[model samples]
Target: MSEEEWIVDGIDHLNYRAVEGVYLSELNVGLKKLILHDYPELSDSSFVSNVHLVKYRLIFMKNVIDKANKKNDYVRETVYEVTKNQAYETMDVQEEWDNTITFGQKIADIVARFGGSWTFIISFVFLMAVWMAFNVLKPFGLVFDAYPFILLNLALSTLAAIQAPLIMMSQNRSSDYDRLQAKNDYRVN
Candidate 1:
């Protein structure tokens, strides 16, 4: 767009305006980033700016294809066709769909992956049972803890208070690792 933005040595060396009638995929990498900024202009009536960006990309890709066609024409042609058929609208739609699917799948995945963690549940149940058993069996002389057992109560309360957070810490670390694995797996494909 500005004279200062032009590059002649790398991608900046090629004059995009020199091939104004080309398609989108042929454009060079630098020009591609430049053109990506004008995606919103596709809806305009004239479409001159949008067309120019697409043409630059098309030209760049075509140049690469020309050099490599003799050794692998089929691959080059396929690449060219795929590139040409892709437009800003198609890319935008794919991006939106990817975002939606990612969010939805993350929710489902988290639930399905670690939702049944039993440690927390078991600890909670055990803690409650300890309290109840102590109260219920007091008259039976199962006196591991006796009436007004302040020391026993203190020990139970302290263990519960400390152990709950430790269990939570372990759960959190595993969950974090699982999430990291999921993210890496998604990216690899």
Candidate 2:
């Protein structure tokens, strides 16, 4: 126990001097007001110990945290109430679009799927090799199209003209599907 005694401001009279003291004017205004607690006897020129000031700081921090927690709880409750009262339904965009897809669109999607695959690349390379070899080598007098293969060039140009539009159509439908999915998600949230 401390043998020395001191009167601390903002709090009740103290009998021990376990900690040092500071002038009330040395503290920040907010901290000073918090400790004062409307005690009329305290003044700006008064003196208080470090222990009492630290205790009041803890109290102030607790009050602020409690107020923030209460606000968070209110927000959580509001969100819960809004979600509970609403009946929400989310739809699968792909399934719904399948029901409405035209035959041409379906064909385009199938062609697009095949065109983008490794199988298409490997098979296309094999076919081109066979065509060029057949034309250049004459293949035991079986080649009707000779070197610089005009017929093969014409076939490639026609395939490109047709395949490009089919791929584009499939991509356009895919974007529309994504838009539908986004709209469905917006509604659900």
Candidate 3:
């Protein structure tokens, strides 16, 4: 190969003119150190595989560029820490959120689950039937809530008011968890 076509390090047989070519020894010292620290296995070999090294280098450079463009030090540090710790693939968003939730949030989730089930619908229908039957069949002038059933309406309204907020809370939590899981998945990929 011509002198101009060869890489500066001459370790890997990669063509300098190749589209994605990158030599391990030719990379920035800090970037190489970071990669080596993150992946100790690569440090053991004098001539790291060009393909693997280039892939990691590209990823590192992309992350660095993105963080720099965004002007966010925290994001850059977080990316570096995650890469170093190798925890991107093992992240469990559901388990993490579950562990951090309060007792009230748990109760809201349970209540929302029950409220959306067929059992709740059937039981509620049966109770309403029984309530109306008793009120209608009671002796004259002795009925607590007659035809209009003001008491039953009040109870239903109160239940709706309370259950609506609880279900919304659970749904909001679920949406947040989904967003977190998606972010983790993106990082892993």
Candidate 4:
């Protein structure tokens, strides 16, 4: 190749244009040190192509991750797993969780979603008002439940008892998902 079209790479010793990567002369001391940490044999004037640069960049990342003071071994393991190019070893937290849901968990999720909505609140208020009005005013000329509304109290109490456990179950699943997401984020970072 013509001298103007191709220049020699100081590290890989291949003929490449300057635009293909970068010259070590342009790098700061710390950056040069990081590069040299992986390719120690490279001279002070090394020219690195982009492809080889990517590999060294990964090494630089590994060095940074290794030096990190994070106390979580899960994060460290995930970083190592990714650095080793075993991407398939890691799973999508949401997808895995969704795939593992049981019928009871699905019902709990639906109940929790509805119980926390405006529609449920409005419907509940309207039902209580209608029940009290029907029993006290005797609008239908026959009050099945008297002013005390014993049946309404029983229904409300039962609803509360069942709703509480379902909502708690949903919250537990949410907490698990948050934990899985945290671990997954570490792998990406």
Deviation from truth (RMSD, Å), model 4? 12.2
TM-score of each: 0.27, 0.66, 0.53, 0.54
lDDT at residue 53 of model 3 (Cα atoms):
66
Runs in model 2 with CA error above 4 Å?
1-87
lDDT tens readout by residue for model 1, 74-187: 777877797686542323433443454445455544543443468757875787677667866875666665556666678869966865555565466457656655665554
Q: What's the distance in Å from true for residue 104, model 4?
A: 0.5
lDDT of 2 by residue, 86-132 (tens): 87777877789889999999999999999999999999999999999
- Using TM-score as the measure, the top candidate is 2
Candidate 2 colliding pairs: none
Local distance difference test, each candidate:
0.53, 0.82, 0.75, 0.83
Sorting all predicted structures by lDDT, with the top scorer first, yields: 4, 2, 3, 1
- Candidate 3, 1-189: lDDT as tens digits: 333553422344344443334444666776677667766554422344456566667888888898787877777887788689664456777778978899989999999999999999999999999889889999554778888899999999999999999999999999999899898888776
Where does candidate 3 stray beyond 4 Å? 1-89, 139-142
> Could you tell me which 10 consecutive residues in candidate 1 have the lowest summed lDDT?
40-49
